[model samples]
Target: MVEFGALPLFLCVMGLFSESLCFVTLEVEVGDNVTIWCRHELIVSGYIHWFKHTCGSAPLIIGCKQFFGSVPSQNCFFFNESERMVVSVQGENTSLTITAVNVSDTGLYYCSSTDLMRITFHETNYLRVKGSESRRQSESAGF
Candidate 1:
């Protein structure tokens, strides 16, 4: 005999929460390159920036940073010098790539999109130094 109530109960026991959209990795050797990818949205057109808000206050510009010169500098953070970050408004991807990953580069990073009118969608991603390959392999095996 089959039980209908049991199936629903089984599913309830499993934790299902937020939906993941993009595939990104922070794999870089001590002297290698690292890229951070995130799903982008069309709502962000004119203004695009990458902020390393370790505590999620606000976002800031990346390269050629002018510290509240023309960009919105709502929060301050401790950033690394060697970190390479890039945002693509065309590809709907706020992916960042860093060369020569160092211990100082590890922190909580957020990819945010904005327009001159309002801020759009943003997703938080972490930068770690190791085991991304194993994690990817494990996810594949599970399916």
Candidate 2:
């Protein structure tokens, strides 16, 4: 038999070990196409959501239920063409592709798996969009 007081502590440690989430960062030049990928080890029966978070503003939901064939939300319509912001999902994996990236696209993006209420797994990716001045500086530095 286990000590009653230690049982709760053990469960908490187990929960921490079970929690699975990760993040990645990407840097891209303006007008370039980039793809952000998220994958999970366990099978997800819930929806996958994408969000964009800026420094001062609240996080905006870019897409929801994308793995279940749902379309992206209107707030995600940053590009003129609808297909420019696309989400593709496969078994245990999902990807968000942005075409012709601009300065406005620079921000933190999050991908999460949720049951439409609570998130199960979450990950954040920081996107840095290189501007013309940065490019010129790099060129001058012979980079």
Best by TM-score: 2
lDDT (tens digit, per residue) of candidate 2 on 6-118: 34323433444221232356899899999888763335345666677776676776765424333332322232324666766766777788999887888777666655445
Cα-based TM-score, every candidate:
0.48, 0.62
Alpha-carbon lDDT of model 2: 0.62
Every candidate's lDDT: 0.46, 0.62
Best by lDDT: 2
lDDT of 1 by residue, 1-143 (tens): 22342233223223232213321334444556766665544442344456553323343445221122233332223443333554333345545667766654655555544445444445556565544554565588993
lDDT of 2 at 104: 82
Off by over 4 Å in 1: 1-28, 55-60, 63-83, 88-90, 130-143
